[model samples]
Target chain A: MKATREAYGETLVELGREHPEIVVLDADLSSSTMTSKFAKEFPERFFNFGIAEANMMGAAAGLARSGKVPFASTFAVFASGRAYDQVRQSIAYPGFNVKIAASHGGLTVGPDGASHQALEDVALMRVIPGMTVIVPADAEETRQVVRWAAAHDGPVYIRLGRSPVPDVFPQGAKIQPGKASVVKDAKGRGFGEMRPEGERDGLDADVAILANGIMVSKCLEAWEILTAEGIKSVVVDVAFVKPLDEKTLIELAERCGAFVTAEEHSVIGGLGGAVTEFLSENRPCPVVRVGVRDRFGQSGTPEELLVEYGLTPGHVAEAARKAVRLKWAV
Target chain B: MCREVRKNVLIMIGTAGSGHPGGSLSCVEIISTLYFGVMRVKPEDPNWPDRDRFVLSKGHAAPTLYAVLAEKGFFSKDLLPTLRKFGSPLQGHPDAKKTPGVEVSTGSLGQGLSMAVGMALAGKLDRKTYRVWALLGDGECQEGQVWEAAMAASHYKLDNLAAFIDFNGLQIDGRVEEIMNPSPLADKWRAFGWRVLEVDGHDVEALLEAASYASESLGAPTAIIARTVKGKGVSFMEGQREWHGKAPKGEELSRALQEVAKS
Candidate 1:
């Protein structure tokens, strides 16, 4: 079965049940954000602020003052840009325990167009002091990240996509905050130590594919095609975007020789830009970013836009091959 | 107590050379009535967690709050002379960190009510009985965030919270309506799900009655809209928008003091 970002809502409700201090806040998009499940079970703990995102941010800060861990939900655009000042002063400046659970992140919020799609939310939120930015790969990873955000301190921004994709991690996989999970290897044949049977680990490769959100599944698919063409590629699921697993990135840069970053956000300040900033100082390598260029996306189906913007599995494979060839040319 | 507070407010605003005398004098009786008669506070133990929380959301009128605090013995009465002066605890606006009795730092408009909501929610969660009160300027209602906070307070059923709207009929730019109409204000607040009460602001007995009603009213937030003149008691400054931010000079100060003496 395919994984969906809505699975984070199930995990969030479960976490709220376990911790009495946990509260869920929604801005009239409870069903959309999947927080309605928690609202149904915990009516008293859930707050529906009726289409006011700014007030929701302020109320979340207020809830934090009362020692309640508030998880505020809305579409990514309003959560980041609409209530930017409120989040800055009330939650970020005071360092409140508020988890901004934003769904429909990046261009994956298809058909809603540019107004709803949150392309620069990651960059805008990550720069705030004491803020934890996480972009999980799939539903299971999103669940783990949500649980981690509750256990962690200060403010956290969790980005979830609207679409469903294949599960990259097996059952019973645990997620740690500020740590990167290496889902596929490029240099070796077998998965790292904890490989499930019948799963091929693309370890022997000249370049590594670093992807986040729903793009992780695309990168894995591309890795298989690249391996078939005799161009081995390692796929790293960079779920934690803020604390970009420097150790794993450095190791991959040294081993793979080149890198390709794929995400659903703008190429200017998304996962690709973060990877470039990391590699430029520590391990300089040939890099190709496969994502939205510096332009707003119009209304279209998710698949159409992905192909139009060159964000499919085939695109990743081509980008990986081009990055490897560029490294050799250098 | 209300008369004494009015006298001090007039004196302080008269000498400060730069203070909001209109709203300050308009809210003098309400502030004095709340501080002296209603609120459960301590002069020395200002940060006592169990004490009731007061947030002056219309923070531009610091003279009213300063006068009340002085009368409550939070500080010496002599400190009133240092109002808005260099190195004075009494700045143009109320700074919670600098002043002794201030609950939250409020200078920017429309934020104090939100902080008061936070305090009330804190009391409910901690199982404390301390009530939270926020004083707002009628003109400050032009801010959208105030309505946002109002909605949350009602949705949360913060019966412990009460807000006082100083309907002094004037802001910096002429009357509130001419600047930006916020009329039918009581109806607007009622629509947002608050128990609204309208009262004569300078009437001490009526102010006490409205506060009593708020205390007894449970299961919803309360807003007491006190109607007042731009500047009360001082004949020269009364009903004048110029007095909203300007202070009386050397000769005008003596005349204002004399007017207070006669009252």
Candidate 2:
């Protein structure tokens, strides 16, 4: 197991070797955000903004305008909230080719507490008109997401975690922007092919557990629990939260009709909120969210915090059962 | 040329019914000097890679920028009356995407200098010779991000960057001295490691002299503190804080235009 941030740091070095125009900026969190790895290799291209996130964002916009692909890194809380106006005016408004790769997102940023955790970052970035938001699930996915962000032409916000997570996708797995990859399908009998239309006659899953970030592994464990109890379900890794894999979600909604959305973020506007907002309008199915319910985080270990916040496998399984029963009631 | 640009500013804001003319009048010479004398820019190719860049950090004074850009043939002068209109490309503040010749979109104060620093750093990175210029309001220095950018520019040794602060001494509330003073401007910039030059903002020759000095400066970025009057050139509007945001109306506009034309 490796932290997504570790993968982010390593991938940046690889990208620097490939793209000469790529520049890195950090607000005194290079060691934590892992831009330090890239900094070590490309000293001239790396800039430390010395704890000023707002100026860093503005500088990134300038660099982008001058034909440089700048990746500005900081904790998600500061990148999304502290420099929000800078991001809105300097980057998103003009549609600059700047990538905001913020690390240590959500409650997984353990001991730092609520002050550092970005519970509302997804919501803040999502509300911006043209901003693209992504929360990578694990190390392998982070590699693909970082490379994808480097090549993308507009403003992209990548949320990465501080805690180490088990590999969700294989080493060579490729991730598509605005697309969710199905890791496991119904009944331990994965569908070799998917029907784009709502052809539910041969559907086998009772519920779909959609998740991103560290919650993807927890949801996978929940899938195992549901399987042991004679319940069938599918687990989907939703990395891109903004342009949300609506096509895949619509197809999943057609078959299962019930879902449990999970993330290591607030229940308000993270993965769960994005799923419900889209599904309620497009498919209108039952979705039970498994996340921190509108409260501040406190200092603790990642394991202790997950259990305390009701974000473990047991909690996800319970939310899945609740969603299934709600579907039946409907 | 300065008088003509000032006339256009008065005409545009006067027609818009509600726009800033005080700060717009204050920096007329600073912007005109750069557009007409300094800065290597092509009006036909707005996005020419090697062209010098200009960012209006005090975006409320967009009327002045629009007037000067039009005067420089960036766009037609006929579109000046559409300021703050629903479907016009001329937004309340500067939008780089919609408007040609605008390098960065800025209205929220204290952010534009940071962007200029970035552009200067990029020029240094690529070993390009194009310079980046930014015009800021004295009142805009109250924002902490400006200082943050000041530190970055000096730390990066961005000699290709130069900024002009229109020190009109008046803001929306009242005199800048009363509204959280950001005075001792030259010393403040010098302390932040900039090559400081104080000049009379209205004198086109002095402004050009400072611009020339900025181009020759060696290591640090240059800060040209241009002392100016809030509402310059116009007889009735000079140094008046009331004209900071109020547009000239009816006879007031004609008197303002006649005074600018006379100047």
Pick out the ten consecutive residues of candidate 1 chain B with the lowest summed lDDT: B103-112
lDDT of each: 0.83, 0.91
Listed for each candidate, the true contacts retained, as a fraction, are: 0.34, 0.82
Q: Per-residue lDDT for B256 in model 1?
A: 81
Instruction: Point out where model 1 deviates above 4 Å.
Output: A1-4, A188-206, A229-232, A246-258, A278-287, A321-330, B1-51, B54-128, B168-174, B199-209, B227-263
Query: Which pairs clash in model 2?
Result: none
Evaluated on the second chain alone, the candidates' TM-scores are 0.97, 0.98
Best by lDDT: 2
* Docking outcome class, model 2: high
DockQ of each: 0.28, 0.90
